[model samples]
Structures are given as C-alpha cells and as structure tokens.
Target: MADEVKLYGVAGSPFVCRVKIALNLKEIKHEFVVEDLSNKSAHLIKYNPVHKQIPVLVHNGNPVSESLVIVEYIDDAWKGVPVLPQDAHEKARARFWAKFVDDKCIPAVFMAIGSHGQEQAVAEAHDQLQFLENELKDKKFFGGDSINLVDISAVFLAFWLGAAEEALGIKIVTKDKFPNLTKWSDNCINCQAVKDSLPPRDDLVSFFKMRFGKA
Candidate 1:
C-alpha cells in the first residue's frame, strides 16, 4: 500500500507554499485540499487542534502541523532529493538560519511592511535582510547549489514579499540595498519546483492589497 498524503492549506499562504515546495522538491504525490481559512474544515481543526492552521500534512492517518515541521517531515519520509544537508555541522547551520528566518526575519519584515515603511521598523527589517545578505553573499542558494530547508523556509521573502511590497508601496529588498539576497530571491523563485508551488503574482498582490485595506 502507498502512503496517503494530504496537505490542508490556503492558496495565498506563504506557509502553505513552503510545504508545497518541499513536496515538489521530493516529487511526493499528494492531494492539496484547499481550506477556506474563515471557515476551516473539521479535519484541519482535528489535525491541528492547538493552532487550527492550514499547511497541515496528514500522512497515512497521522497528522503533522506547522509548515516547517511538515517540510522536515516530507524530507524525512521521502528519499530522493535531500532538503537538508547530510553533514552534521552544515545541517545544524541550515537549521539555525531557517529558524532565524522564521523568528527574526519574518517578524521584522511584517513590522516594516505592515507599518508601511515606518523608519524604525524599516531599519529593523533592513538589519534582518542584511544578515541574510551576508549569509548568501557567496552561495547560489541558502543550501549551496540547490534549495534546502533554509530556502524553503524563506520562500515568503523570495516570492510573497514582492507582492506585499507592490501592494504596500514599500521597497525593503532592493538591488541597491541587498544585492546578494535579491539575486538569491530571483533564483529561488525561478527554480522549477519553487515556481510550480507559488501562487500567481497578480493574485497574491491583489490579496495583499485587499487584506491590508490598500485596495
């Protein structure tokens, strides 16, 4: 018998995109069950009772919640392309950067973009992007030649941030400010697997505008 894999997700969610990219990278066959976030399904609530969020991966009857967790799970469960590095130290470093993208970079980005480029928030966001700029200063991707856990984790910055910037009329990641990171973003979004997983740019831009009342 084959594994019964189902991903519960919303179309516009960057978190859901992360899991989708991971699945695509591994070439995992699964069902994408789109969830109306306003009226979440019983399976979503039952799988992730704590957060009741999308991007829940149900594999062979067991449930896994959280986008990053699901990505790691897919990488572990499937064996072909490695989303995480095999070396101990490199793997640890990759995990560290992915966590940073979530805990530090994401909040700073939201604060800056959500505040509509307020000086202080923009400064903090810049600092976060700069950190990534330094990290990606030499590599083609965060995982070196190919996408990895870190690249998957930072997909929001690669794709969704462009839509958010257009909708909010802000410029956080720019060629002048973050050349390396900007280049990396372009590469990530252009990667076949990542591109296949992203929502349409126009749709995402429209979503940000409406959701932020900028429409």
Candidate 2:
C-alpha cells in the first residue's frame, strides 16, 4: 500500500512554503489543498482544531500542524537527503537557528512591513537582519554548503522578504546593509529544491499589495 499525503495551505504563505520545500527535497508526492484563509474550510478546522491554522500535513490519516514540526516530520517519515543534521550538537544548533528565524526574524519582518514609516519596527527589522548577517558572514549557508532545516525555516527571508520590500517600496535586506544575508537569500532561492516551490514574484507582489491595502 502506498502512503497517502495531503497538505492544506494558503497561497504564498512562508510557512506553507517551508513544508513544500521539505516535501520537494524529500521527493515526497502529496496533494496540495489551497485553503481560503478568509473563509477557512471545515477540513482545515477539523484537521487543526487547536490553532485552526494552515500548512497542515495530513499523512495517512494523521494530521501534523505547525510548519517546523511538519518539516521535522517530513524529514523523519521520508528517507532521503536529511533535512536535520546527523550530529547531535549540529542538530541542536540547527534547531536553535530555525527557532530564532521563526521567533525573531519573522516577527521583525512582519512589523517592518505592516507598520509603514514606523521607525521602531523598521529599526527592529534592521537589527534582526544584522544579527542574521553576522551569523551568515562566515558560512555559505546556515547548514554550511547546503540547505537544511534552518534554511527551510528562513524561507521568508529568501522570498517574502524581497516581495514585501518590493510591495511596500521599502528596502530591508540590501547589498550594503546586509550583504551576507542578501547573498544567502540568493543562494537559498536559487537552490534546486526551492526554485520551483516559490510563487511567481509578480503574483507575490500583487498579493502583498492587496493584502496591505496598497493596491
């Protein structure tokens, strides 16, 4: 019997993109169910009752919620190129950075994009970007030489960061300001596993414009 896999996600969501990247890396075949976030489907509610959020991975009948958790699940369930590191310390380090991307970088980026002309939010985002830049300065990738769970977790930096900047007419990551991060972003998005997973750039810009009421 073949394994059954289904993914419920919203269009252009960074979290959803994370799962998509992971599945693609693992070469896992699954059905993608795009959810109407404004009028979420009953299936999404049933599958993820607690958070009622998207990027739900339903495997063989069991549902997995939360993007990072679902990513770890994909790495575990499928035997392919490992997403998480094999060494114990390296795995822990990867998890820490992934969590940092989710907890720190994401919120900063959101605040910077959502709060127009807000000095504080923009500054916060800059600070976060600086931190990431410093971390990435001496490495090719967060996982060193290749993409990993940390890279997947930071997909927002790769795609949506640029999209948000373009849609809002605000520049966050730049060649001068965050040179390393800018290069890392390029490396990440250009990776074979991630290239096809991203939404079209123009579509994303339009989506952000409409989403932020700039359209």
Candidate 3:
C-alpha cells in the first residue's frame, strides 16, 4: 500500500512554500489542501492544535507541524534525492544555516523594511546578510551544487524579498551589497521545482504594499 500524504497550508506563505519546495525536490506526490488562515479550518486546527498554523503535513494519519520540521521529516521519509547533506558535519551545517534563517535573518529583514528605526534596522539587516554573502562566496547553492535544507528554508529570500523590496520602494539586496547571495538566489528561484512552487510575484508585492501602506 502507498503512503497517504497531505499538506495543509495557505497560498503565498513562505513557510508553506518551504514545505512545497522540499516535497517538489524529493518528487513526493501529495495532496495540497489550501487553508484560509482568516477562517481556520477544522483539519488545520486538528493537525496543529498547539500552534494552530498551516504547513502541517499529514502522512497516513500521522501529523507533523512546523515548516523546517516538516522538511526534515520529508527528507527522512524519502531516501531518494537527499534534501540534506550526507556528511555528518555538512548536514549539521545545513541545519544550522536553516535555523539561522528564521532565528536571525527573518527578524532583521522585517525590521529593516518596517516603519520605525529604519537606520539601525537596515544596518543590522546588512550585518546578517553579510554572513550569508560570505557563506556563499564561491558556492552555487547553500547545499553546494544543488538546493537542500538550507536553500529550502531560506526560500523567502529568493522570491518574497524581491516583492517586499518592490512594494516598499526599497532595495536591500543589491549586486554591490551581496553579489554572491544575489547570484545564489537567482539560481534558486530559477530552479524548475522552486519556480513551480512559488506564489505569483506580483500578488505578493501587492500584499506588501497594502500591509506596509507603501501603495
């Protein structure tokens, strides 16, 4: 018997996009059940009662929540097309970078574009981005040659960041600022799986414009 897999998430969510990209990379076949976060669905509530968030993966009745956790689960469950590195140290590095994306980078990026404290926030954001830029000095992807856990985890930087920049009329990621990261992001978003899984760029830009009152 085949395994039953279902992902509950809303469109245009980067966390949700992370799961979708991981599944696509692994070539996993699953049903994508969209959830309206404005009005929570019973299944979403049932699967992720603790957080009550989307991007919940249900495999054969077993539920997994959290975007990165779900990606790790997908990698572990599927042996083919490894989503993480095989080497112990490298795999650990991938996990570390993935965690950094959420713990450090996300907050910095948000603050940089936010209304209050633009000067300090932009500096902090660049500091964080420098770490990533240095990390990608000569690498094509965070996973080295191909996208992996780190790349999937940081998918927001590839697409959503651009939308935010366009809508807010600010440019954080620039060729002069982060050449390597800029190149790496280009490769990531252009990948067939990542491209297919991403939400429409224009829609996301509009969303940012509305939210930040930049429209």
Full-model lDDT for every candidate: 0.91, 0.89, 0.89
For residue 184, what is the lDDT in candidate 1?
Answer: 94
TM-score of each: 0.97, 0.95, 0.96
Candidate order (lDDT)? 1, 3, 2
TM-score ranking, best first? 1, 3, 2
User: What TM-score does candidate 1 reach?
Assistant: 0.97
**Candidate 1 residue lDDT tens string, 75-126:** 8999989999999999999999999999999999988878887889989999
Tens digits of per-residue lDDT for model 3 on 103-201? 999889988777533777888988998998988889999988889998998888888888888888888889998999899989999998899799999
Error of 3 at 209 (Å): 0.7
Error of 2 at 173 (Å): 1.3
Rate residue 119 of model 3 by lDDT: 72
Cα shift from native, residue 21, model 3 (Å): 0.7
Collision pairs in model 1: none
Worst lDDT window (10 residues) for model 3? Answer: 111-120
By TM-score, the better pick of 2 and 3 is 3
Number of the top candidate by lDDT?
A: 1
Local error of candidate 1 at 214, Å?
4.4
In model 2, where do residues sit more than 4 Å from their true spots? 213-215
